[model samples]
Target: MVVIGSRTPTQIDQVPSAAQIVEGEQLREQTSTGVDLKTALGKLVPGLDFGPQGRTNAGQNMRGRSVQVLIDGVSMNNSRSLSRQFDSIDPFNIERVEVLSGASSLYGGGATGGIINIITKTGEAGGPSWESAAGVTTGFNNSNDFDHRVAQSASGGNDFVTGRIGVAYADNGRHYDAKGDEIFPDIAQSDLQGNRSIDILGNLTFRLSEEQTLDLKAQLYESGYEGDHGVYFPNLDSSTPNLEDAEIRKGFSADREPLTDRRMLNVNYHHANVFGQDLYLQAYHREEESSFHPFPYPDSDGSYYFTTSKQNTTLSGLKMLMSSDITGNVSLDYGVDIDREEFDATQMYFDDDTTDATGGLVHEEERVEPRYPGFQIDGLSAFVQSEWQPTDNWTFGAGIRRQHMDVAIDDFQPSGQSLAEGGKSDYDVTLYNVSALYDFENGHQAWTSYSEGFDLPDPSKYYGHPGQSVSDNPLDGIKTRQVELGWRYQGSRWLTQAAAYYSWSNTTIEPDDNLNIVQRDDKRRDYGLEASATRFLGDHWQFGGTLHALRSEQKIDGEWEKRGITVDPYPSQHTATLHAQWSDMTRSLRLQANRSWDYADYQGDEIEGNTTLDLIGSQRTDFGKISLGVENLTDEQYSTPWGQRAAGFYSPRFGPEYLYDYQGRGRTYTLSWSLEY
Candidate 1:
């Protein structure tokens, strides 16, 4: 039964048995707020570590290896940074999220870790239907945010179409101190704090004939944030001015404005009886652009002091898949994929006082155009898999993939200087996986597997800077080795799962001293144990919990001074959450409570363990639905990966002397109402 809910294997034949489908509904519920997918998943899945930090996206660590994310079966992780955000997709549009907990190279290079697939909504064969809903909420810290959404779908004859569009806007007020009297510093002032987003989605499907069908999909997303940097400054003269007044005098010095826009288009066709087997073909293109302007200031001389940067990315790919039943007890699946990606970036520096130091201000303006340049990457992969049921209680699966990658910088220049006269690199990778599933007589199952994964060097990493030492000598690709064993039991109202895994990676890529280029040659290993359980407490109550214990270590092969320079970015051990939900006889009213714990061992040297609690009550009626909730009931002080100490560094450094703060939101409450049609 669990296999039915497990992630669909890319090779089709290497499907999971009964122990891999653990977090589905829980993932959807945790991500309802448009938070980063990794953060949401971390709350439910054991052995997963994720939080907001270095970049806007969530960083993920699964089974001691990095994890890659895919939206609608398309890779979303930026090849250069390995960071991506899932906020662009509306939660309402997701059909499901499938997490494959181990290394997988069959999908393509770049997945030296695990993989997550986000499946989008698709029209089903039926009639026409329309749905719409809207909600508004006001919470503690004077927080007020509202969300409205509407969707319509229909299927007639042999054609089907569906469209969904939504917009969400929030203006979260400043948070107060522990005593609930003073406002926290670094937070945006009451006048400057707010965030807004817009999302649009469309999909159309046409049945060309009995053996062929066509599908088209497109999506657009835009979001912006206006807020102060999460930092507090001591008053210049504490004795002369009050903290509030002193902050006001500073004129909201710490502020950031960021804007992001993204679009995706896809066209796919599926046909059966093509070349005597079921065939699938798809074409997809995605474009994303983002800009950030921090601390924009209008100077006295009609000039502005600002720092702005823009990034643009484009991706296109085509894939073909075929499957056939070779025998009564055996099946085969094969596929080929070709993908290309390009990225371009620009950063500008301007100064208001263009003239030399003097009383007169010069009108001449100078501009510095530092081009990030652009590059192209081509990937080709072919894979074959077989599933064989040799016995009544056992099943065996094996798959192999041969992949080739070609990367080149297209007219790449660093500050207008040529790099390697346009460089290119090619690599070949071979990956194999073997798995077995055994079902006992009592509805219990066990599984064991071994798999390999790899990631090629991205073009950006090789061509970003010219004449840079390490940039001149590109490193080889990265690779991972993984082995896992797990067991599962499912009863009428109770479910339990447990697993243990060990993973090792070679030539890990990491930022060097320059921070402009990355160097490879680091080795790392991760081993962990994880368990989860969900059970019914009563006729109307259900509870669930997940726990994890992990150890990760890294070693850089260099001089003694640098040999131990290892950083464990993920929590070593943690108990994610405990949640319970109950409903009264009326079925119209419901209550829910959740508590999460991060143990001391889970926190880095600079971080401390903290507990968070949330409560919610909802009521439904003919007119609409209403819900009230409170979060951070204890108002605990904590910091996440997003906390920072250095002025230009986005990542927070852990340690007592670092003087870093997490700046978590204090106690907050919310009241929401929804109208449905």
Candidate 2:
């Protein structure tokens, strides 16, 4: 199979890194479990940490680091992450997902963990075709706990032109835990339940000539919460600690609700041969507007004020890549990228004098101000890589990239803080990677690689602090170095992969004791082992499993210790997943089990772990294809790692609230129907 480990397409066996492709069918099957893309990916990928299935991707990590998300070839990430990259698009439009594990400079910043490239569906050479699907989900705890979804797509093409368009809509409802308690919505980060979402994807391709082509693509997605429920802290007025979880009170009305809107457009061109080299070029634009839930924060003087936050971000870039053969045994791939990102955030205040227990009861607007100084970052980069097959069984490759960034910020003080004004900052960095692969005739391959990746810390967060200076910037870029060793085996009925990796960075990002975002110039390291195996039990049955063991630590006071919840909040010492599948032309069945091992953090908190099971089955009939999914088949009771971190962060300052626990949803059932012709 062909894969793009770098910009150039190459054979999977020739790639020096671990890579996996989740086909559309697999994605559909996973979606049947009524989980979002983040949760679905975590179950399918061994090294990816799947946090609570929510709208915010707060604790989700790939290989214990940040992951760069991409749709088609356009980047969905900016310096100031909204933590909503997974919600940028609907899964119905995705043809497949490509996952490249470990760190590398092959892409750009924000890939310190790895990369997840979502490939959208494109029309093939065929007559007009259409696909439609509908699904419903419920936790069964209450009559109101029901969700609905519908999607449709159409595609048609001739010899000269081909195109496809798809649209999906979902109306989600409330959720409940195994104990039959309402799952409270996260007031700060927000949650996915009780939300409505819509996504649109369209693309057109033209065969300019036999050796040339052009493609145009666009997508728009939006998700907004209904705000039917609000958080109620039973201990809000109590001085003593209360063990009650944050409760969800119904009929909580609000004039404004949290929302996320994303828009992207792309123009891509390709030529089979240009000056004896294959050429590819793409120009893209991505824009997003995100608004958070309004919450009340107490001022130093004791009065409380209601505030909401909104962020607008835009990214535009042009990328070009060319591949050529230097000789029969040698090849070179090179590319150049020019991009710019501009971000702005605003905070809106609401008069709190008339507000009730639920925040933002008073609709009277007060004022609006910049949450942080607006900023624009421009980057220019160029890279080249060469691959050589010195012998029939060996391949070696190396590459380097030079990046230059200029950050410009508007002169403004952080809200509710006395801070130095923002100005300009410039940075230059060069990153490199090297790899070697050995292939064997017996379907076995071994590979080793070393790579470097980097990302600039969120300027908006650091710049919002007091006494900040552009020259004395605390938003230093973090550079990570990674080394990995891996082995892969592909037999007639069995496929397997095993890999070990370690990554280190001198400067780490974490929250201070007061839950304030901070940058610590201390050495931090993350190490992990990952493995996956799939076997065909028979002509119609298959079995597979994945395993991951990870640890993150930092040097403090000249001693190494496990990172705390504020830093490495994933809390999974070891995670494993097993699955069995049976399929035929007319029917299919799948069963999956996932387990997280218990572990302790640096603060000596015994983080409890849990296990869950899922089952899905489908049958095709003359009317349509019908499917049913049961998530958490055994009704597991567990608190999300992110939720636990929330409790840890709030307990010291406030008191125990039910919402702080972030309990996992209980058993859920989804029924779906689809038709394609």
Candidate 3:
């Protein structure tokens, strides 16, 4: 009902951009902080901007660019993405979450601006059904910081076989904010939020007779952590100035259990009359791996050594689809896509003196990663879309796409050879989009759209320094242009939406927080306005709200520079969210609040803004359902505008104890229970 399913390319029944849908009964009333998906999409979506202790991504800036995290549709970044991709999985294997919000010229090339699809958990349409769930969350300033979760599933089969199986697990502890500190971990953070996670899923279907169908799926995810003491900080002499005890974390050592693993597999086939068209076919594969153990090197005789780092990413794909009906009112959809990818990194070293001048812990001598190369990519695509409705409420759509790309690099060398020894990057381009919609009989609805998207350039800038090649125009691409207008209403209880957008870019890219290095900026501009509403007060109460405003600019020295305006980025020109709910029947209760405003950082200076409040309650019975939640109810001692712009631009020039460990995990409380049959 929140705009029917979209697979675009002439399947347009509706679309004008600015789309959203959360379902899963609103993820069971917010599963008490929901446990990632960036904490349940930071309160039901709105140009996302978290980290006021809600952490997910402090900059996925939907309307300002950056977004394209999918699940059932594959692609979880990994093409050199470092937004941590909202903790991979475990929203209890989600079953809903679809947001468009901006730029999606047929869902290609980093989505240029937005698109997040997460659709999992399937199996239920006839026969046997079983679902089980569990939950726990703790914090009132430390009950050992708590976290827990468990899940199970069982689906049924008939009509020639159908199946589903699911499993889940999560564990966490150690989190403190609102003056209670504790988050100072290191190494880019992500052991699924540091320590413990597991998920597995499977599904199968084969209904041959009913128009032919076939499906298969598999997935696995893992995260873990181990530390002996962790945390170390001290003004490192950045022109010292009485630092706040180096932001505390007291420098200790030992950490040899940092891991992450991900896997995926998929297959599909459907037909409902081929030649006349309705066919669909697909194939997929994925893999991701990460590791970091003991890091602290210094050997050449002076002793003390430890290093073991690794990362591997592999992706594979294939796809095809068709849809036809051209006559009575028009219809057409087309597709063909292919992809292959690999990203690899390595590092090794051992010997950390188990007791004396480094002898007892030789640990299989090593030293392999430093200028390591290995980045590959290949892609091919084709597309077409069409839709037209001449009567009822008028609608029209258009689409086109063509993509071809190739980038390669392997052959490594030069730990010291003066530089220049790597190369490769091939290119191809063609992307397009157009839209329109209107449906009013008093219910209201209106839309308009134009889209084009692109992004590519960051193969560690050609195999990360120390000698590089391939840069003159491997068909250079990094373009974006978008425009949008929208309005919607679905009364009977009230529901509303509004949108306004504008975008321009020739390029934009960032990275350099603690120096991961990667920056590119060129004429860029972004504009925005968004509005939302929901109402129902009759039987028990209900009210909802949302508002967002944005602005981003660039062009450097020639004026027009407003990227984070002095540090406090996370795309916050203005943001607001309000919620209220109360129910009858079994029982339900909800309360939410959010706000972020107070801009001007990119050298313009001035940053400070925060407001948070949350609460959730539920009760249902027939043998299942119970929940309670409270997050930062008021314990806001805040600090998260990406940790106040990384402690106002790198804490005193890079060492104010590196403070800004997102000080806002404060007030927290949660309880959960679940079941269904």
Model 2 TM-score, 2 decimals: 0.96
What range of 10 consecutive residues in model 3 has the weakest lDDT sum? 354-363
- CA lDDT, every prediction? 0.54, 0.82, 0.67
Compare the candidates by TM-score and give the number of the best one.
2
- Residue pairs in candidate 3 whose N, alpha carbon or C atoms collide under 3 angstroms: 10-386, 232-251, 420-467, 564-602, 565-601, 565-602, 566-601, 566-602
lDDT (Cα, 0-100) at 173 in candidate 3: 70
RMSD of each: 6.4, 2.2, 23.9
Q: Which stretches of candidate 2 lie over 4 Å from their true place?
A: 233-246, 357-364, 414-416, 513-516, 568-573, 654-657
Candidate 1: minimum summed lDDT over ten consecutive residues — where? 355-364
Please give, for residues 26-132, the per-residue lDDT of candidate 1 as tens digits: 44344333233555666666656544422244234565456666776677766655344555665555656666677787567656556766766665554444444
Best by lDDT: 2
Q: After TM-score superposition, what is the CA distance of residue 17 in candidate 2 from its true location, in Å?
A: 0.9
Candidate 3's C-alpha runs over 4 A off are: 1-15, 18-37, 42-78, 83-103, 106-108, 112-189, 192-348, 352-368, 371-421, 446-488, 496-535, 543-580, 583-677
